[model samples]
Target: MEHYHDRRLVEQTWGSSNAYTGSNYTDYPYFPTLAKQLLPNLRCVQVVEWAPMSDNVYNDGWDLKLKTPDGDGAATAAVASSQLADTSLDCMFVYFDAVDLAGHSSGFSPQNPSYMQALENVDVHVGTVLNALYARPNYANENWLILVITDHGGIGTGHGGITYEERHIWWIGSGSAVAKQQITGPDPGTYNLLGTGIFNQSGVDQAKLKQSPVQADIAVTALHHLIYETGINPETYPFWVGLDGKSWLSQFSGVDKDMERNNIKVFPNPTTGIVTAWFENPTNDHVTATMLDVSGKVVAQHNECSSTNKITLDVSGQPKGMYVLQIKIGEQLLTRKVELK
Candidate 1:
């Protein structure tokens, strides 16, 4: 297990033995872009991150508290509510991958006190972070809205998805910016990022807060909002284009609540040998589907029938690993990850 963990780091940290040492994943380019989006010309955008910790040191992975101002909860509150006593900076975004880690490792059961204790510790950590914000000046002005959320709800029954339990995460807000503001709208369709958080965008007016049904777009969504809100041109950010699943951040500009995209599908993703492609209500006509191997070689091609939205493929002989499944409908094209079994 230790080797398994170390190998992952060696492979990612030092990179492959043959690698020309391309940018480390940490240099993913978006970090600086995010920093620019949040702080702009300002500095001291401190990002304190802490992962799995414990009340009992016996199981280091399960503990949720540390000796300092770090932990998923602290990071989360800093992003959601406590920007600073003066709001001297623009905004913040926090991430809590701990609970997800715990779930992945321990299955979210209270069978071990550590699981329950970790959850309790998160609550306590959140309480302290909130206390710090309220104890400081200007935070009570209610100008702030804090959004508490899990990045993505974890698997229930040892799995992950939008299942009722896995998908049902939390969202909470308290401050002057959001007072009794309730968001009611159509469900975000098909996306896996829909209902995994509870939050309040503190330090801003609730009326101006943007509502998005598709959570998959938040990376781009937040970046664009910050660009406009902070008066920064997006072209200056090299990583902005790849931050979101799609490039046109402005396309989701309006508050039309209906969120549906029935444009594409790749079935039986972990295909045992065969899989089918389907196009649903595409915005274009004359669609074509193709399967390409990892080396970018075309393995199969089909001129999909116009009337049928589906195309079947005999992928039984393809090697096991990742392959690109491309669907081209008129001018629109999308790629989905396909795994061969």
Candidate 2:
């Protein structure tokens, strides 16, 4: 289990082993750490490692017991309920591994009674957490985005292989921000092989077996809702360009017009100093570019009356952080995020 955390840290950091050394997961830039840095007022909590043999500690700000009790799932639920009651808590990550344990002990198929029972137990625990969330005193005014996801699936009694069952998993998100629609994967032709074998079998175009949602999108969706609810500019954080997925909420609605049309292209996004924006076509209209900090205050501005298709914003003098870039040309307006390292 501890190795699992290490491997995940390595993967998230783009295979940078130097970022995670000697069982220290805090060295990596995790989403929770970034969230706390972005919003000091926001309280992030993590409850993980329900397995008995697991170390049960991955990163800082974890507020649960180190040892799992006999009924670990129920214990996790109790902690989740208690944490959700805290008004200061802005985000909480709870992990329950009873189903995984059951699958490993018995079998990873629906035909296994023990695995099914473990799933049912976890479902009850999830229900308890949801009940506690709804019981919040300020639930009426608060907006929450609840996401449930799994790292991987299993085949027979074990996983970790490149089998289709081990790769194919599901994600469930429910909240005010999430659209009330089910997103499923494209059908892998021939229903006969669906239940009997892996979906990515020979003769099936693996490229066409794409899905509407991805696991990486989970982080982006959470960040999007957090920014929207807190009224913080997305550019305030330097990790947007490094995000591996797009927000699911942005897929159905709230699309940025400037980004949708791709009329302007920003290169070297995570730049150290200078950033360039190339327009699709040259504009004769007067162009004005304003650079704003995290507080929405203008830190720098550029004005160009000459006809050109490119604009450059220099933030070499500014501190290392994220800044918003707004460009106005005639009646057309465009916005971009700039990262200064």
Q: Which of the numbered candidates is closest to the native, going by highest lDDT?
A: 2
> What lDDT tens digits, residue by residue, belong to model 1 across residues 1-341?
01111111122222122122332233232322344533335322323343221221121111122223444465466554444454554344444445545666676765655556667767876776667567666555533344455433434424344344543433444444234544453443322333232121232232322342223333344444444433323423322333322212334333222222346677898788687987763443676777766544667677764656787777677788776666666655555667887
- Candidate 2 weakest lDDT stretch, 10 residues: 190-199
**Model 1 stretches with alpha carbons more than 4 Å out:** 1-39, 44-89, 109-114, 138-143, 156-164, 172-175, 189-341
TM-score computed on alpha carbons, candidate 1:
0.39
Tens-digit per-residue lDDT, 1-341, candidate 2: 11223234222222122223344445433445445444446677766654422352364433333443545399888887988898877787777888888888898999998989999999999999999999999988898989888766678877655466765667888976556777765743311122322212453434543345655557656666665533333323343444444466654445551232347788788888788888754548788777777655677888888877788888788888888777777656667778888
Cα lDDT of candidate 2 equals: 0.62
- TM-score per prediction, in order, is 0.39, 0.63
